[model samples]
Target: MKIIRSRDFTGSHAWEALDIASMNGITTRLHWTDQPYRWHVNDGEEVFVVLDGEIQMRYRENGQEQVAVLKVGDIFYASVGTEHVAHPLGVARVLVVESKGSV
Candidate 1:
């Protein structure tokens, strides 16, 4: 068993992550970022949880672009084939769960 303080985590680069756990082909990770992630579709489903700070989540739907402001405790679910990206307002910590090796 392990305990993590999300607010105490930081990375040397954007989107750097701490591997938390892996179960049944899925992986849970804690990420620290001050930059945006590239827009891409996951191979499977993805669950994004804001642990600290805020994020501007941009996604595509029906060929249109949309955005959602996600703050602490907010969660974003991305199903297969869903294209999305995350832009942090500043330094942010996020918990992400998705299939192993998913992009």
Candidate 2:
């Protein structure tokens, strides 16, 4: 077992670990005050869990924009190649697990 300290990372309120060889990883986000906003497309499917605070999923439709807010204890998912974005609604924290190849 391993313990990752939240203070390990400076300026960023998040930590990540995954199957380096398999390109799978898990990431934890602190709060929006720490720029909890994230825009990433995983190499594979991924899941997001709102542990604390709030988060919002952003996406574009017909050149317009849309959002889905998620509160604590909420969960969501994204598929590979599906362009999407995420950001904390306020001082929100989240955990995301996904496959990331070769570190």
Candidate 3:
């Protein structure tokens, strides 16, 4: 068993993640970032939870770009084929759960 204090986590680069656990083919990770992630589609579904700070989540739907403001405690769900990116308002910690090896 392990205990993690998400607010206390930091990384040297954007989107650097700390592996938490893996079950079946899925993995859970804690990420720290102050920059935006490149747009990409996950190989499977994804669950993004904001642990601290705020994020501007951008996505494309029906060929139109959209954005969502995700604050601490907000959750974002991305289904397969959903092209999306995350832009942190500042330093942020996020918990992400998705298939192993997914980008």
Candidate 4:
């Protein structure tokens, strides 16, 4: 097991690293300080779990829409192949889990 502080690094509004996983999934923990960034899609689906503070999930919908406001213990999932931008209502930390499998 490993523990990481979101701001343990420098020049970053957020911090994240892969902890442990094998063949099944990958788990990552990230911390943000009321600063949300745009999410770039690559591969696999991702689930964001809010660890602290509040985060507002945003997505493009012709105009713009507020997906939802997530707080501590709140869980949200985003599908692959989409662009998203998250805005922090307050200092926020989140654990992001991504995996590739079908079952």
Q: How close is each model in CA RMSD to the real structure?
A: 0.4, 5.1, 0.5, 4.9
Report the Cα lDDT for candidate 1: 0.98
Give lDDT tens digits, candidate 2, residues 17-53.
Answer: 3221223254333322334445556677777777666
Per-residue accuracy of model 4 over 5-46 as CA lDDT, tens digit each: 653532344533334344545545354555667656637777
Tens digits of per-residue lDDT for model 1, 38-72: 99999999999999999999999999999999999
For candidate 3, the lDDT comes to: 0.98
Minimum summed lDDT over a 10-residue window in model 1 is located at 3-12
**Model 2 alpha-carbon drift over 4 Å, by segment:** 1-33, 36-38, 61-64, 101-103
Worst 10 residues of 4 by lDDT: 9-18
Q: Candidates' lDDT values, in order?
A: 0.98, 0.56, 0.98, 0.63
Report the C-alpha displacement of residue 46, candidate 3, in angstroms. Answer: 0.4
Distance (Å) between predicted and true CA of 49, model 1? 0.1
What stretches of model 4 exceed 4 Å from their correct place? 1-12, 15-25, 61-64, 99-103
lDDT for 43 (candidate 1): 97
